[model samples]
Target: MANITLFAQAIGRLPKECIRKIIREEKTDKHSKGYDTWSQFISMMFCQFSGCDSVRDISNGLNSANGNLNHLGICRAPSKSTVAYQNAKRDSGVFRRIFYALLAHFGQQAVWQRTRYRFKMPIKLLDSSTITLTMSLYEWAHYTTRKGGGEDAYIA
Candidate 1:
Protein backbone atom coordinates (compact mmCIF):
# COMPACT_ATOMS: atom_id res chain seq x y z
CA MET A 1 0.00 0.00 0.00
CA ALA A 2 1.21 3.52 -0.74
CA ASN A 3 1.78 5.64 2.33
CA ILE A 4 -0.27 8.81 2.52
CA THR A 5 0.68 11.67 4.82
CA LEU A 6 -1.82 12.68 7.46
CA PHE A 7 -2.29 16.03 5.76
CA ALA A 8 -3.17 14.35 2.47
CA GLN A 9 -5.57 11.97 4.17
CA ALA A 10 -7.24 14.84 5.99
CA ILE A 11 -7.64 17.05 2.90
CA GLY A 12 -8.62 14.07 0.76
CA ARG A 13 -11.83 13.73 2.74
CA LEU A 14 -13.02 17.24 1.79
CA PRO A 15 -16.08 17.44 -0.52
CA LYS A 16 -14.32 18.10 -3.82
CA GLU A 17 -17.53 18.05 -5.86
CA CYS A 18 -19.16 20.65 -3.60
CA ILE A 19 -16.06 22.79 -3.74
CA ARG A 20 -15.96 22.58 -7.55
CA LYS A 21 -19.62 23.50 -7.79
CA ILE A 22 -19.05 26.58 -5.68
CA ILE A 23 -15.97 27.47 -7.72
CA ARG A 24 -17.88 27.23 -10.98
CA GLU A 25 -20.72 29.33 -9.63
CA GLU A 26 -18.32 31.98 -8.36
CA LYS A 27 -16.26 32.03 -11.59
CA THR A 28 -13.17 32.46 -9.49
CA ASP A 29 -10.96 31.20 -12.29
CA LYS A 30 -12.38 33.39 -15.05
CA HIS A 31 -8.95 34.55 -16.12
CA SER A 32 -6.66 32.27 -18.07
CA LYS A 33 -3.73 31.28 -15.90
CA GLY A 34 -1.85 28.24 -14.66
CA TYR A 35 -2.48 29.16 -11.05
CA ASP A 36 -6.21 28.54 -10.61
CA THR A 37 -8.58 28.86 -7.66
CA TRP A 38 -8.31 25.18 -6.76
CA SER A 39 -4.55 25.47 -6.50
CA GLN A 40 -4.91 28.57 -4.38
CA PHE A 41 -7.36 26.78 -2.09
CA ILE A 42 -5.01 23.84 -1.65
CA SER A 43 -2.11 26.18 -0.95
CA MET A 44 -4.07 28.08 1.68
CA MET A 45 -5.28 24.84 3.29
CA PHE A 46 -1.68 23.65 3.42
CA CYS A 47 -0.66 26.89 5.08
CA GLN A 48 -3.31 26.47 7.79
CA PHE A 49 -2.61 22.78 8.43
CA SER A 50 1.16 23.24 8.50
CA GLY A 51 1.15 26.40 10.59
CA CYS A 52 3.07 28.26 7.89
CA ASP A 53 4.13 31.78 8.91
CA SER A 54 4.32 33.22 5.39
CA VAL A 55 3.80 32.59 1.68
CA ARG A 56 7.44 31.62 1.33
CA ASP A 57 6.93 28.88 3.88
CA ILE A 58 3.83 27.58 2.07
CA SER A 59 5.59 27.59 -1.32
CA ASN A 60 8.74 25.93 -0.01
CA GLY A 61 6.76 23.40 2.00
CA LEU A 62 4.69 22.36 -1.01
CA ASN A 63 7.70 22.33 -3.35
CA SER A 64 9.52 20.07 -0.93
CA ALA A 65 6.58 17.67 -1.19
CA ASN A 66 6.90 17.57 -4.98
CA GLY A 67 6.36 13.84 -5.24
CA ASN A 68 3.30 13.86 -2.97
CA LEU A 69 1.46 16.88 -4.36
CA ASN A 70 -0.47 14.73 -6.81
CA HIS A 71 -2.52 13.45 -3.91
CA LEU A 72 -3.60 17.03 -3.24
CA GLY A 73 -5.04 17.21 -6.85
CA ILE A 74 -2.64 19.83 -8.30
CA CYS A 75 -0.20 18.97 -11.09
CA ARG A 76 2.54 20.90 -9.28
CA ALA A 77 3.13 23.18 -6.35
CA PRO A 78 2.72 26.93 -6.86
CA SER A 79 5.56 29.45 -6.59
CA LYS A 80 5.80 32.04 -3.83
CA SER A 81 4.84 34.84 -6.23
CA THR A 82 1.88 32.92 -7.67
CA VAL A 83 0.57 32.07 -4.24
CA ALA A 84 1.04 35.63 -3.02
CA TYR A 85 -0.66 37.13 -6.07
CA GLN A 86 -3.64 34.78 -5.87
CA ASN A 87 -3.97 35.53 -2.16
CA ALA A 88 -4.10 39.26 -2.93
CA LYS A 89 -6.28 39.13 -6.07
CA ARG A 90 -8.76 36.33 -5.49
CA ASP A 91 -12.25 37.23 -4.21
CA SER A 92 -12.43 36.17 -0.58
CA GLY A 93 -16.14 35.38 -0.89
CA VAL A 94 -15.32 32.22 -2.83
CA PHE A 95 -13.39 30.83 0.11
CA ARG A 96 -16.05 31.89 2.55
CA ARG A 97 -18.67 30.05 0.52
CA ILE A 98 -16.51 26.99 0.33
CA PHE A 99 -16.15 27.00 4.13
CA TYR A 100 -19.90 27.21 4.62
CA ALA A 101 -20.55 24.56 2.01
CA LEU A 102 -18.16 22.16 3.70
CA LEU A 103 -19.63 22.85 7.09
CA ALA A 104 -23.09 22.02 5.79
CA HIS A 105 -21.82 18.91 3.99
CA PHE A 106 -20.38 17.60 7.27
CA GLY A 107 -23.60 18.37 9.17
CA GLN A 108 -21.82 20.86 11.40
CA GLN A 109 -23.15 24.22 12.48
CA ALA A 110 -21.48 27.58 11.95
CA VAL A 111 -18.45 28.33 14.12
CA TRP A 112 -20.24 31.17 15.91
CA GLN A 113 -22.89 28.73 17.14
CA ARG A 114 -20.38 27.22 19.59
CA THR A 115 -20.04 30.47 21.53
CA ARG A 116 -22.78 30.31 24.18
CA TYR A 117 -22.02 33.62 25.87
CA ARG A 118 -21.05 37.07 24.69
CA PHE A 119 -18.52 39.26 26.45
CA LYS A 120 -19.32 42.87 27.27
CA MET A 121 -15.88 43.98 26.11
CA PRO A 122 -14.54 43.22 22.69
CA ILE A 123 -11.92 40.54 22.45
CA LYS A 124 -8.33 41.38 21.56
CA LEU A 125 -5.84 38.93 20.15
CA LEU A 126 -2.08 38.84 20.59
CA ASP A 127 0.30 37.16 18.25
CA SER A 128 3.28 35.42 19.75
CA SER A 129 5.12 34.94 16.50
CA THR A 130 6.64 31.57 15.69
CA ILE A 131 9.67 33.36 14.29
CA THR A 132 12.55 33.98 16.65
CA LEU A 133 14.62 37.17 16.67
CA THR A 134 17.93 38.03 18.24
CA MET A 135 17.55 39.55 21.70
CA SER A 136 20.19 42.18 20.92
CA LEU A 137 18.24 43.30 17.83
CA TYR A 138 14.88 43.33 19.67
CA GLU A 139 15.68 44.64 23.14
CA TRP A 140 12.05 45.60 23.83
CA ALA A 141 10.86 41.99 23.69
CA HIS A 142 9.72 40.29 26.88
CA TYR A 143 8.48 36.75 27.51
CA THR A 144 5.29 36.05 29.46
CA THR A 145 4.74 32.99 31.65
CA ARG A 146 0.95 33.07 31.35
CA LYS A 147 -0.83 29.94 30.19
CA GLY A 148 -3.48 30.02 27.51
CA GLY A 149 -6.94 30.41 29.09
CA GLY A 150 -9.28 27.45 29.14
CA GLU A 151 -12.37 27.25 26.99
CA ASP A 152 -15.83 28.47 28.24
CA ALA A 153 -14.12 31.09 30.38
CA TYR A 154 -12.83 34.61 29.72
CA ILE A 155 -9.44 35.86 30.77
CA ALA A 156 -8.99 39.44 31.80
Candidate 2:
Protein backbone atom coordinates (compact mmCIF):
# COMPACT_ATOMS: atom_id res chain seq x y z
CA MET A 1 0.00 0.00 0.00
CA ALA A 2 1.01 3.66 -0.33
CA ASN A 3 2.91 4.87 2.70
CA ILE A 4 1.42 7.87 4.57
CA THR A 5 2.50 7.27 8.16
CA LEU A 6 5.35 9.76 7.93
CA PHE A 7 3.14 12.46 6.48
CA ALA A 8 0.58 11.85 9.19
CA GLN A 9 3.32 12.10 11.76
CA ALA A 10 4.38 15.46 10.36
CA ILE A 11 0.84 16.76 10.64
CA GLY A 12 0.67 15.33 14.17
CA ARG A 13 3.54 17.63 15.15
CA LEU A 14 1.07 20.49 15.67
CA PRO A 15 1.35 21.44 19.35
CA LYS A 16 -0.34 18.90 21.61
CA GLU A 17 -1.54 21.59 24.01
CA CYS A 18 -3.31 23.47 21.23
CA ILE A 19 -5.09 20.34 20.07
CA ARG A 20 -6.06 19.43 23.63
CA LYS A 21 -7.48 22.88 24.35
CA ILE A 22 -9.52 22.93 21.14
CA ILE A 23 -10.94 19.52 21.90
CA ARG A 24 -11.46 20.29 25.57
CA GLU A 25 -13.24 23.62 25.34
CA GLU A 26 -15.01 22.97 22.07
CA LYS A 27 -15.82 19.30 22.71
CA THR A 28 -18.15 17.55 25.07
CA ASP A 29 -17.82 14.54 27.32
CA LYS A 30 -17.10 11.38 25.35
CA HIS A 31 -17.92 8.67 27.88
CA SER A 32 -21.46 9.85 28.46
CA LYS A 33 -24.26 7.36 28.78
CA GLY A 34 -26.96 9.07 26.74
CA TYR A 35 -25.33 10.28 23.52
CA ASP A 36 -22.21 10.50 21.40
CA THR A 37 -21.01 14.05 21.02
CA TRP A 38 -17.64 15.62 20.25
CA SER A 39 -15.40 12.60 20.73
CA GLN A 40 -16.29 10.88 17.50
CA PHE A 41 -16.92 14.16 15.67
CA ILE A 42 -13.67 15.83 16.64
CA SER A 43 -11.52 13.37 14.73
CA MET A 44 -13.16 14.32 11.46
CA MET A 45 -12.65 18.02 12.19
CA PHE A 46 -9.10 17.32 13.26
CA CYS A 47 -8.57 15.63 9.93
CA GLN A 48 -9.94 18.75 8.23
CA PHE A 49 -7.87 21.19 10.35
CA SER A 50 -4.97 19.02 9.24
CA GLY A 51 -6.28 19.59 5.68
CA CYS A 52 -8.29 16.44 4.88
CA ASP A 53 -11.02 17.63 2.50
CA SER A 54 -13.67 14.96 2.78
CA VAL A 55 -14.78 12.29 5.22
CA ARG A 56 -14.09 9.64 2.59
CA ASP A 57 -10.56 10.94 2.09
CA ILE A 58 -10.03 11.30 5.85
CA SER A 59 -11.33 7.78 6.37
CA ASN A 60 -9.00 6.42 3.72
CA GLY A 61 -6.08 8.49 5.02
CA LEU A 62 -6.56 7.52 8.66
CA ASN A 63 -7.34 3.90 7.92
CA SER A 64 -3.89 3.65 6.36
CA ALA A 65 -1.82 5.86 8.66
CA ASN A 66 -0.80 5.16 12.27
CA GLY A 67 0.66 6.91 15.37
CA ASN A 68 -0.63 10.38 14.42
CA LEU A 69 -4.34 10.15 15.22
CA ASN A 70 -3.76 7.65 17.99
CA HIS A 71 -1.46 10.16 19.61
CA LEU A 72 -4.36 12.61 19.58
CA GLY A 73 -6.46 10.06 21.54
CA ILE A 74 -8.28 8.60 18.59
CA CYS A 75 -7.71 5.11 19.96
CA ARG A 76 -9.49 3.49 17.06
CA ALA A 77 -9.43 5.21 13.72
CA PRO A 78 -12.95 4.63 12.48
CA SER A 79 -13.76 3.07 9.13
CA LYS A 80 -16.19 4.77 6.77
CA SER A 81 -19.00 2.47 7.89
CA THR A 82 -18.32 3.24 11.55
CA VAL A 83 -18.25 6.97 10.86
CA ALA A 84 -21.48 6.75 8.91
CA TYR A 85 -23.09 4.85 11.74
CA GLN A 86 -21.87 7.38 14.30
CA ASN A 87 -23.11 10.27 12.21
CA ALA A 88 -26.47 8.61 11.80
CA LYS A 89 -26.79 7.89 15.51
CA ARG A 90 -25.73 11.24 16.90
CA ASP A 91 -27.81 14.38 17.47
CA SER A 92 -27.28 16.59 14.44
CA GLY A 93 -27.67 19.63 16.70
CA VAL A 94 -24.10 19.10 17.83
CA PHE A 95 -22.86 19.55 14.30
CA ARG A 96 -24.99 22.63 13.83
CA ARG A 97 -23.72 24.13 17.05
CA ILE A 98 -20.13 23.59 16.03
CA PHE A 99 -20.69 25.03 12.60
CA TYR A 100 -22.32 28.22 13.87
CA ALA A 101 -19.75 28.63 16.56
CA LEU A 102 -16.92 28.39 14.06
CA LEU A 103 -18.55 30.89 11.71
CA ALA A 104 -19.34 33.35 14.51
CA HIS A 105 -15.88 33.18 16.02
CA PHE A 106 -14.21 33.77 12.69
CA GLY A 107 -16.61 36.56 11.89
CA GLN A 108 -15.95 38.32 15.18
CA GLN A 109 -12.22 37.90 14.77
CA ALA A 110 -12.38 39.42 11.31
CA VAL A 111 -14.20 42.47 12.69
CA TRP A 112 -12.06 42.93 15.80
CA GLN A 113 -8.68 42.37 14.17
CA ARG A 114 -9.56 44.74 11.34
CA THR A 115 -7.72 42.47 8.93
CA ARG A 116 -10.45 43.46 6.48
CA TYR A 117 -7.78 43.86 3.89
CA ARG A 118 -6.90 40.19 4.15
CA PHE A 119 -10.54 39.18 4.38
CA LYS A 120 -11.70 41.45 1.56
CA MET A 121 -14.02 39.98 -1.02
CA PRO A 122 -12.14 38.65 -3.98
CA ILE A 123 -12.39 40.54 -7.27
CA LYS A 124 -12.34 38.72 -10.57
CA LEU A 125 -11.32 40.48 -13.79
CA LEU A 126 -12.32 38.41 -16.81
CA ASP A 127 -11.31 40.71 -19.64
CA SER A 128 -11.58 40.20 -23.39
CA SER A 129 -7.80 40.56 -23.55
CA THR A 130 -7.29 36.92 -22.53
CA ILE A 131 -10.03 35.69 -24.95
CA THR A 132 -8.76 34.35 -28.26
CA LEU A 133 -10.56 33.67 -31.54
CA THR A 134 -8.61 30.42 -32.12
CA MET A 135 -10.78 28.39 -29.68
CA SER A 136 -14.00 29.86 -31.07
CA LEU A 137 -13.07 29.09 -34.67
CA TYR A 138 -11.82 25.60 -33.76
CA GLU A 139 -15.06 24.73 -31.92
CA TRP A 140 -17.31 26.15 -34.70
CA ALA A 141 -15.32 24.34 -37.43
CA HIS A 142 -14.84 20.98 -35.67
CA TYR A 143 -18.15 20.74 -33.83
CA THR A 144 -20.55 21.98 -36.53
CA THR A 145 -19.77 19.07 -38.85
CA ARG A 146 -22.87 16.96 -39.49
CA LYS A 147 -22.63 13.42 -38.10
CA GLY A 148 -25.15 10.58 -37.61
CA GLY A 149 -27.58 12.34 -40.03
CA GLY A 150 -27.00 15.67 -38.19
CA GLU A 151 -28.34 14.40 -34.86
CA ASP A 152 -24.84 14.73 -33.33
CA ALA A 153 -24.58 18.28 -34.61
CA TYR A 154 -27.90 19.16 -32.96
CA ILE A 155 -26.69 17.54 -29.68
CA ALA A 156 -23.47 19.61 -29.81
Candidate 3:
Protein backbone atom coordinates (compact mmCIF):
# COMPACT_ATOMS: atom_id res chain seq x y z
CA MET A 1 0.00 0.00 0.00
CA ALA A 2 1.13 3.52 -0.77
CA ASN A 3 0.78 6.49 1.57
CA ILE A 4 -1.01 9.30 -0.28
CA THR A 5 -2.02 12.61 1.21
CA LEU A 6 -5.38 13.99 0.11
CA PHE A 7 -3.65 17.03 -1.30
CA ALA A 8 -1.37 14.89 -3.43
CA GLN A 9 -4.27 12.73 -4.61
CA ALA A 10 -6.32 15.77 -5.66
CA ILE A 11 -3.48 17.58 -7.39
CA GLY A 12 -2.31 14.33 -9.00
CA ARG A 13 -5.45 14.31 -11.17
CA LEU A 14 -4.49 17.56 -12.91
CA PRO A 15 -2.74 17.41 -16.28
CA LYS A 16 0.75 18.52 -15.35
CA GLU A 17 1.83 18.71 -19.00
CA CYS A 18 -0.92 21.18 -19.78
CA ILE A 19 -0.08 23.28 -16.73
CA ARG A 20 3.60 23.24 -17.60
CA LYS A 21 2.80 24.31 -21.17
CA ILE A 22 0.75 27.23 -19.88
CA ILE A 23 3.55 28.21 -17.50
CA ARG A 24 6.04 28.13 -20.36
CA GLU A 25 3.78 30.17 -22.62
CA GLU A 26 3.01 32.73 -19.93
CA LYS A 27 6.69 33.10 -18.94
CA THR A 28 5.50 33.50 -15.35
CA ASP A 29 8.91 32.49 -14.01
CA LYS A 30 10.80 35.04 -16.06
CA HIS A 31 13.51 36.91 -14.08
CA SER A 32 12.60 35.04 -10.88
CA LYS A 33 15.76 34.00 -9.01
CA GLY A 34 14.61 31.65 -6.23
CA TYR A 35 10.83 31.57 -5.93
CA ASP A 36 9.70 30.46 -9.39
CA THR A 37 6.21 30.23 -10.83
CA TRP A 38 5.72 26.58 -9.82
CA SER A 39 6.66 27.36 -6.22
CA GLN A 40 4.30 30.33 -6.24
CA PHE A 41 1.48 28.20 -7.62
CA ILE A 42 2.03 25.45 -5.04
CA SER A 43 2.19 28.00 -2.23
CA MET A 44 -1.03 29.62 -3.40
CA MET A 45 -2.72 26.21 -3.55
CA PHE A 46 -1.43 25.46 -0.05
CA CYS A 47 -2.91 28.72 1.20
CA GLN A 48 -6.23 27.86 -0.43
CA PHE A 49 -6.27 24.32 1.05
CA SER A 50 -5.21 25.47 4.52
CA GLY A 51 -7.44 28.55 4.55
CA CYS A 52 -4.56 30.83 5.46
CA ASP A 53 -5.58 34.41 6.29
CA SER A 54 -2.21 36.05 5.59
CA VAL A 55 1.27 35.48 4.22
CA ARG A 56 2.60 34.79 7.72
CA ASP A 57 -0.12 32.20 8.23
CA ILE A 58 0.80 30.51 4.96
CA SER A 59 4.49 30.54 5.93
CA ASN A 60 3.71 29.03 9.30
CA GLY A 61 1.42 26.38 7.86
CA LEU A 62 3.96 25.33 5.26
CA ASN A 63 6.77 25.37 7.82
CA SER A 64 4.72 23.02 10.02
CA ALA A 65 4.36 20.64 7.05
CA ASN A 66 8.04 20.82 6.11
CA GLY A 67 8.37 17.04 6.05
CA ASN A 68 5.60 16.74 3.46
CA LEU A 69 6.98 19.37 1.10
CA ASN A 70 8.52 16.67 -1.07
CA HIS A 71 5.08 15.14 -1.71
CA LEU A 72 3.81 18.58 -2.82
CA GLY A 73 6.72 18.81 -5.30
CA ILE A 74 8.22 21.82 -3.55
CA CYS A 75 11.79 21.82 -2.28
CA ARG A 76 10.87 23.82 0.83
CA ALA A 77 8.30 26.14 2.33
CA PRO A 78 8.47 29.76 1.11
CA SER A 79 9.18 32.67 3.48
CA LYS A 80 6.54 35.32 4.14
CA SER A 81 8.59 37.99 2.35
CA THR A 82 9.18 35.73 -0.66
CA VAL A 83 5.52 34.86 -0.95
CA ALA A 84 4.50 38.52 -0.59
CA TYR A 85 7.09 39.71 -3.14
CA GLN A 86 6.03 37.08 -5.71
CA ASN A 87 2.35 37.87 -5.17
CA ALA A 88 3.00 41.61 -5.61
CA LYS A 89 5.24 41.26 -8.67
CA ARG A 90 4.00 38.14 -10.52
CA ASP A 91 1.46 38.53 -13.33
CA SER A 92 -2.01 37.49 -12.11
CA GLY A 93 -3.08 36.54 -15.62
CA VAL A 94 -1.04 33.36 -15.41
CA PHE A 95 -3.02 32.13 -12.43
CA ARG A 96 -6.28 33.22 -14.06
CA ARG A 97 -5.46 31.27 -17.18
CA ILE A 98 -4.56 28.22 -15.13
CA PHE A 99 -7.82 28.49 -13.19
CA TYR A 100 -9.92 28.57 -16.36
CA ALA A 101 -7.97 25.68 -17.80
CA LEU A 102 -8.53 23.58 -14.68
CA LEU A 103 -12.21 24.51 -14.59
CA ALA A 104 -12.69 23.39 -18.16
CA HIS A 105 -10.85 20.18 -17.44
CA PHE A 106 -12.90 19.31 -14.34
CA GLY A 107 -16.21 20.43 -15.86
CA GLN A 108 -16.01 17.50 -18.29
CA GLN A 109 -15.59 14.90 -15.55
CA ALA A 110 -17.77 11.75 -15.55
CA VAL A 111 -19.26 12.67 -12.16
CA TRP A 112 -21.30 15.47 -13.76
CA GLN A 113 -22.96 12.96 -16.09
CA ARG A 114 -25.21 11.79 -13.26
CA THR A 115 -27.07 15.10 -13.06
CA ARG A 116 -30.80 14.76 -12.41
CA TYR A 117 -31.69 17.20 -15.19
CA ARG A 118 -31.94 15.96 -18.78
CA PHE A 119 -30.09 19.01 -20.06
CA LYS A 120 -26.35 18.39 -20.26
CA MET A 121 -25.45 22.06 -19.83
CA PRO A 122 -24.13 23.18 -16.48
CA ILE A 123 -26.62 25.06 -14.28
CA LYS A 124 -25.79 27.87 -11.91
CA LEU A 125 -28.34 29.01 -9.35
CA LEU A 126 -28.47 32.65 -8.25
CA ASP A 127 -30.66 34.31 -5.58
CA SER A 128 -31.24 37.96 -4.74
CA SER A 129 -32.36 39.85 -1.61
CA THR A 130 -32.64 43.42 -0.35
CA ILE A 131 -31.83 45.09 2.98
CA THR A 132 -33.07 48.48 4.06
CA LEU A 133 -30.49 50.95 5.34
CA THR A 134 -31.14 54.16 7.16
CA MET A 135 -29.97 57.24 5.28
CA SER A 136 -28.36 58.67 8.45
CA LEU A 137 -26.48 55.47 9.25
CA TYR A 138 -25.44 54.64 5.67
CA GLU A 139 -24.63 58.04 4.23
CA TRP A 140 -22.25 56.47 1.70
CA ALA A 141 -25.03 54.30 0.23
CA HIS A 142 -26.66 56.03 -2.73
CA TYR A 143 -29.48 53.68 -3.69
CA THR A 144 -32.00 54.82 -6.22
CA THR A 145 -35.54 55.06 -4.84
CA ARG A 146 -38.47 53.96 -6.93
CA LYS A 147 -41.85 55.62 -6.57
CA GLY A 148 -43.31 52.54 -4.86
CA GLY A 149 -40.72 50.96 -2.53
CA GLY A 150 -37.39 49.11 -2.46
CA GLU A 151 -37.68 45.91 -4.51
CA ASP A 152 -34.26 44.27 -4.50
CA ALA A 153 -30.56 45.03 -4.93
CA TYR A 154 -27.37 43.05 -5.48
CA ILE A 155 -24.56 44.46 -3.38
CA ALA A 156 -22.01 41.98 -4.62
Compute each candidate's TM-score over C-alphas.
0.68, 0.47, 0.67
State the displacement of the C-alpha of residue 130, model 3, in Å, after optimal TM-score superposition: 20
lDDT-better candidate, 1 vs 3 = 1
Model 3 RMSD in angstroms: 8.4
Clashing pairs in model 2?
Answer: none
lDDT values of the candidates? 0.82, 0.54, 0.81
Better of 1 and 2 by TM-score: 1
lDDT for residue 51 in candidate 1, whole number 0-100: 99
How does candidate 3 fare on TM-score? Answer: 0.67
In candidate 2, which residue ranges exceed 4 Å CA deviation? 1-36, 46-56, 70-73, 114-140, 144-156
Q: Write the per-residue lDDT of candidate 1 for residues 47-79, one digit (tens) a residue.
A: 988999999999999999998888788889898
Q: Please write out the lDDT profile of model 3 over residues 1-156, one tens digit for every residue.
A: 988877778778877788888999999877988778878888888788878899999999889989988776778899999999999999999989999998888887856776565768766665576566666666554476422223464433
After superposition, candidate 3 runs with Cα above 4 Å error: 1-3, 110-156
Model 2 lDDT per residue over 52-150, tens place: 776677677666654655554566567676666676765565566666666665577668887435546676554332222344445543333442111
